[model samples]
Target: MDQPEGLTAVGEEQKVCRLQRSIYGLKQASQSWNTHFDEVIRGYNFIKNDYDPCIYKKISGSSVAYLVLYVDDILLIGNDVKMLADIKAWLSTQFSMKDMGEASYILGTKIYRDRSRRMLGLTQSSYIKKVLKRFKMALKTRSHSHEAWD
Candidate 1:
C-alpha cells in the first residue's frame, strides 16, 4: 500500500495508504467474496454442504434445489422447475450475472439428460480427445476382437 506507482505522497514514504474498499488481487479479497456469497445464500435458507463448502442446498416443502460453486462459475440443479426459476431470478437481482439457460457443459464434462427415462449422463469425450491430441495419441484407434482370449 506504500503509495502506488506514479502517485507521489507529500508525507512520509514509510506510511502505508489505507484502502477505501476491498481491493482485488489481495488474499483477503477472495475470502471476503466467498464469505459474502455464503451469507447471501444462507439468507435464502440454503445450507452449505458438509463435505464441500462451495455447495449449498435448499429444501422447501417437497421441492429441493442445489447450488454448486466453482470459482466464479455456478451450476444450479433442482427437481422443481418453479423453484429453480425463482432462485435464478432472485440471484440475478442481487448480482450481475448472465444466465446460460439450460446447463450443457460444466467443469469440462458434458451433461446428457433423458427425462422420460429419468437418466442422466456425464461425459468427458471431448476432454479426453483434446488430452490425447496434445500427447500425439489421438490417431490411435481401439482394436475390437469378437473372439475371446484364452
Candidate 2:
C-alpha cells in the first residue's frame, strides 16, 4: 500500500517510526489515534477533558467514568464499570481493538487496584529490589515506600 504522508507504508516502519512532528522535538503519530478516539467517544456523550483532552470523562448522576488510551492500549477507570464496558465495546466496534481488561502492568510498573477501596497504586518494588540486590543494598534491612531511594 502507498504510505500516507504522516504514516510509513506497511513493512517500512520497523520500530523506526518516521519523524513527523515536534512539540520541542518530533512527536506526531499520536495525533491520528487521538483524533479518531476523541471523535468516536464524544459521539457517545464522552467528553474529552478540556485541559487534557486526551483524558476523557463520562458522567451520569453519582457515576463518574473514564476511558484513557495511549496509542492502542486502553486503561479504564471508573465507579460505574458498566458504562466503561459499553464505551469499550463502542470503541472496539469503531477501532478494531484487542481489549485487555484491567491493567496490571504499564510503563514497566505493576499496578494494583483494590475496587472495594477504590484505591490505585503502582510500584516497581520487584524491579527495585532486584536492582538493590544486584548492588547488595537489599541487606540494609530498611523497607520504605520506595521513597527511601528517592
Candidate 3:
C-alpha cells in the first residue's frame, strides 16, 4: 500500500479523479469502499466495530455473526451454520462477492484449524512441493532452506 501518485489532498479544496493502475491501493478508494460496504451491512442490521473498524458484528438473541474485511477480502465468522450462506446471499445482492470457504491456502501457506484440539497450523508444504516441482527437483534431496543455491 505504498502512497499512490498525487494521493495527497494537496489542499485543492476539491477532489480529483485518478486514471492509473495502483498497487492494490487507490488512495481514498479503500476508505470509500469500506464506508459503502459498512453502510450496506449496517442496513442489513450488522454493527461495525468501533475498536476495530475492519470487524463487523451482528447479534440475534443467542446467535452472533462476525465479519472481518481486509481490503477486498472478507472472512466471516458465525455460530449459526447458515449465517455465512445467508450473508453471502445478502452481500451478493449489494456487491460482487466470492466466498472462499475454510481458507486452505493463502499467500502460499495452508491454514488448518483443529476445533476439538483447539489448535491452528500454517504450513507451506504444498507451496514447497510446488516450488520444488517448478525447479524440476522432484527427486532432489530435500534441504529445509531456500538459500541453498548449490
Query: What overall lDDT goes with each candidate model?
Result: 0.89, 0.75, 0.80
lDDT of 1 by residue, 1-150 (tens): 678876766666677878766443676777888998999999999999999999999999999999999877889999999999999999998788999988899989999999999999999999999998999888654546623552
TM-score of 3: 0.57
The TM-score between candidate 2 and the true structure equals 0.61
Cα RMSD for candidates in order: 4.8, 8.8, 10.4
Highest lDDT model number: 1
Off by over 4 Å in 1: 1-24, 144-150
- Residue 34 shift from truth in candidate 1, angstroms: 0.5
Q: Give the C-alpha miss distance for residue 1 in model 2, angstroms.
A: 10
lDDT of candidate 3 over 1-150, digit per residue (tens): 334576755675365565465555667887888889888889999988899998999898888999888888887778887777788888888997677678776667888989899788889998888988999987665576855765
Which structure among the candidates has the greatest TM-score?
Answer: 1
Segments in model 2 whose C-alpha atoms lie over 4 Å from true places: 1-29, 115-119, 130-150
**Model 1 worst lDDT window (10 residues):** 141-150
Question: TM-score per candidate, in order?
Answer: 0.77, 0.61, 0.57
